[model samples]
Target chain A: MIELAGVTKSFGANRVLAGVDLSVGRGRSLVVIGGSGTGKSVLLKCILGLEAPDAGRITVDGRDAATGDREAFLACFGMLFQGGALFDSLPVWQNVSFRLLRGALKRPRAEAREIAIEKLRRVGLSPDVADKVPAELSGGMQKRVGLARAIAADPQIIFFDEPTTGLDPIMSGVINDLIREIVSEMGATALTITHDMTSVRAIADEVAMLHGGVIRWTGPVAALDASGDPYVDQFIHGRAEGPIAALR
Target chain B: MRLPLSLLAALGAAVLSGLAAVGRVTLFALATFRHMLSPPFYGREFLVALGNVGWLSLPVVGLTAFFTGGALALQIYAGGARFDAQAVVPQIVALGMVRELGPVLVGLMIAARVTSSIAAEIATMKVTEQIDALVTLSTHPMKYLTVPRVLAGIVAVPLLVGLGDIIGIFGGFTVGVQSLGFNPSVYIRNTWDFLEPLDVISSLVKGLAFGFIATLMGCYAGMRSGRGAQGVGRATKASVEGASVLILAANFLLTGVFFSL
Candidate 1:
């Protein structure tokens, strides 16, 4: 479980997040839908402690996220970045097994490699792809590799940032399905941010619409269609004329 | 008067920002040292950095020292001819190369080669979100990336400077014997006798300082880089510019220190 209360962050004159309050229960997949530059990524970063919130508090399972051994706090979570963020210098297997190859979670080299291959396989990748670097992979394959890495350690919570951004519709569906399956199977709390309606329908157990640096609407995914909030209706419908300006 | 006031205000802002940057760099350097001394030491990363900063730098450092040594010898010989002091070429060449050129040239070459590469690589990593990913995976980016490269620079550049000093002296010897018509044994003897142990120590000390400054600037510029390709380019450029100027300034201060001490 995660909770954020009155979280506010500003970059100079630009206030990206202001008075944001959000929470996600354990083992639930919450997809935050918002237009581009809506501070969705910033919200995620604040939760992960990657970016400090100017004013507010965040807690995970009741412990203050700001005051703990950072490594220990981070150990319970995994993240798949928007760009895959695989280490360019490392092979695919090493990227997937990165957490296992170092730190307190370290495994023997051979065992780590085996686990990487297994995770890669679970993400619909072949063992042959393990030795190749991320650059060698196609965009969809790279996304799959990123997903494999996020779930490799069997983290209790996973954050997916734009998980299907650059992929084709079919690949997006595949990734959405994979994410849905993984979250369900691992019973992990999942927080994802995306504007993709297709992905939302496929993966979200609950939907939260973020706009103007606050949660405007939130309900079960089934209730998304009739949420009755103008922002949520405009966003889910992808209307050019709506509360969210088409031209920024 | 209003225009002059505006100009003064602008200058004042620049000075303040410059001071702020220096403060940030000082803190970054302290953190790097702290992480370096503490463990979960990354031996493999450190070893790879040693290879990159040390072994791979041999050719450029060698060539720069060799050519500069020869040029210094020629200039010294020609200058010495004015006062019928051509015989002093070996001693002067030895002093100039060992006391100044060897470490400075090698340091500059490293700034261009190793510093730029480190900055570009780290900046690209930051831009790509790999740095953020490192944090999510519970690896301290400073420990994983910065400490290894800085340690390598500190450990390796002194050796490169020492090698450059030797090759530079040999280059002078070759030119003196073959082209300047000096006896090889006499040239070697003069170079050896003219050099004090203090000169060698100062040269190595300069190497250590230059090395630390160059690599630290790279890591600092990189870790603070903004997003996208332009950010990477800016970081690379800033790293080289900062490293070069600092190395030169450090060389001057270090020279004064050595002489005074």
Candidate 2:
């Protein structure tokens, strides 16, 4: 379980997160939806301890997450970035088993490589792709590689940041299904931040809408369509006639 | 009155912000150093960094030292002809290469090439969210990225500087024998006699310090890069400029410290 209470963050004069509170239960998928620059990413970063909250507490698994041995706290979670940020210099297998190949978890190079390849296979990538660098893979393949790496250590919690941002609809659907399957099979707490309705529908057990640095609505996935909040309605229907103004 | 008040306010804010930023960055550096000393040392990453910072850098370092040494010899010989002090050519070349020219030139070359490369690569990664990916994977960006590269720079630069000094002295020797009509044996002897151990040691020390500054500034600028294409470009530019300036400043301070004693 994860809980964030009254978290606030500011960059210079612009306050990105303002007294935001949220919680996600274990073995549940919570998706945060918001338009660009709405602090959805900042909320995730705050929970991950990448960005320190100015005012409040974040607890992961009932432990204070904001201050402590951050490495140990982070070890319990995995993240899949929007851009599928695989290390360009390393081959797919090395990238996947990066954590396992290091200290405390150190295995022989061959054993680490074998584990990496197994994870890749789980993500629908072939053994042939294991030796290839990230630059050689297509966008969809890279996202799979990123996903494989995320699940390599069998983390208790997983964070997905815009898992379908740049992919085609088919690829997005594939990724969304993969995320759902992984979350269900592992029974891991999943938190995803994205604007894509399809992704939310496919992966979220619960949905939260972020606006003005605070969650405007939180309910089961089914309630998103009928939430009746003007902002939620405006955002979900993609209508220009509502309170949300077009950038033009 | 409005302009003056605004200016004062801006100045005050700038000072405070600068101090805050420095404090934050210092904390980040300390954390990185601590992680480096702790377990989970990424040997593969370290090896890759060594290859990047050491082996790959040799060609540029060698070429720069060689050309600079040859040029220095030519210039010294030309200047010495007027005073009929041509016998000082070998000694001056050796002193220049070991004491100042080799380290400074190699440092500048690295600042130009390696610093910009690291900055641009990391800034692009930042813009693309790669650093965040590392953070999310339970990897400390400081440990995974900055530590290996910074540690490699510390280990590799001194070796490169020593190599540069050798190449540079040889360059001067080549010019002295082939171009200046000097006895090769006598020139080598004079060069050896003029160089003190202190000069070589100073060069190595300067190299290590400059290398640390170059890579640290690069990583700092890259990690702090904002989102988008323009942000990455700005970060790259800032990194190169910052690294170059820091290297020169550090070189001066290191030289002063070494000679002051």
Candidate 3:
């Protein structure tokens, strides 16, 4: 399980996460939904220890997340960034197998490549694409490659940031299905941050809506529609004129 | 009263910001050095950086040194005629190339070439979130990106400067023998006999300092860059400017320390 209490972060004068408290149970999928610029990414980064919280405690599986050996703690977690941030210089297989090829997880180059190719296949990519660089892939392919990389080491925990952000509806559906299938098969603890309702409905076991740097509502995926909160209601229906003021 | 006060405020603000930028770069350089000494060093990355900064730079450094040396020989010949000291051409050229021009010119070229390239590549990586991806993949961006390049600069640029000094003096020799009415054997001997080991060493040291400054500025500017294409462009420009100014300043300091007498 992962937990955060009073997690706060700010960039210069602009406060992003303000005294936020949230958690995800082990072996469960939690999707944190929020609109643009609502600190969804910041919240996720804080959990990953990528951004230090001004005042907060984050614990994973009953241990302080930031207190342990960073490599060991991080080895258990897999993350897919919003932009499919693959290493531009490396081939697709190298990108997928990066962790395996270096540091404490170092393996033979050929073995790492073989595993990378296997993961690529798991993500619905052919072996032929393994030698190509990330630039050679399309938007959807890049995301899949990123997904393959996330699961390459068989991490026990996975975080997907905007998994279906820029794809077409068909591609989004395909990605959502892949995410769902992978999570189920691996039984990994999953935390996803996205504004996509379809993605939430498809992958989430529970849902948390973040707004104004706090969890506005939390419930099961099925109960999201009838949560009865005005902000939740305003958000789900996509109404412009609502309690949630639009950005200029 | 308002005008003067506002102008003062603006001046103060600029000064404060410049100080802050210096502080940031200093901290960044320290961090890079710290990571370089720690475990899990990236040898492949270091090798690649060396190749890019040292080997690939030979052609341009060689070409620039060659032309500068040729021009200096010509200028020395023309100016020395009035004083009847035209025979000092080889010695002057040797001293000029070995002690000052070789390091400075190579430093500037690195500022233009390597520093700009580092800033652009890293800024683009920052824009694209590749740095963040690196973090996720259990890597320090500094160790992977900055340390290797900076260390390479320290290692490779000295060699480049030494090569540049030799090539530059050779350029003078070529011009002196072919164009000027000078004895080839005496000209070569004058170039060789007049050069001190200290001069060559000082030139290499200047190269090291300039290389460090150029590369550190690039990485610092790039890592701190804002989002988008415009941000990357601005970072690249700032890197080159910072590198050029720092190289020149360092050149002066190194010269003073090396030749105080």
Best by lDDT: 1
lDDT of 3 by residue, A1-248 (tens): 89989888889998888888888988899999988999999998888888998988999988897797888888888988899999898899999999999988899999999999999999999999999999999999999999999999999999999999999999999999999999999989999999998999999999999998888899999999999988988888888988999873
Better of 1 and 3 by DockQ: 1
Runs in model 3 lying further than 4 Å from the true structure: none
Off by over 4 Å in 1: none
Clashing pairs in 3: none
Tell me the deviation in Å of residue A19 in model 1.
1.4
| By DockQ: ranked, best first | 1, 3, 2
In order, the candidates keep a fraction of the true contacts of: 0.97, 0.76, 0.67
List model 1 lDDT by residue over A104-140, tens digit each. Answer: 8999999999999999999999999999999999999
| Alpha-carbon TM-score of each model against the true structure | 0.98, 0.92, 0.97
Model 2: DockQ score: 0.64
Clashing residue pairs in candidate 1 (N, C-alpha, C atoms within 3 angstroms): none
lDDT accuracy of residue B195 in candidate 3:
87
TM-score (0 to 1) for chain B of model 1: 0.98
> Pick by TM-score: which candidate is best?
1
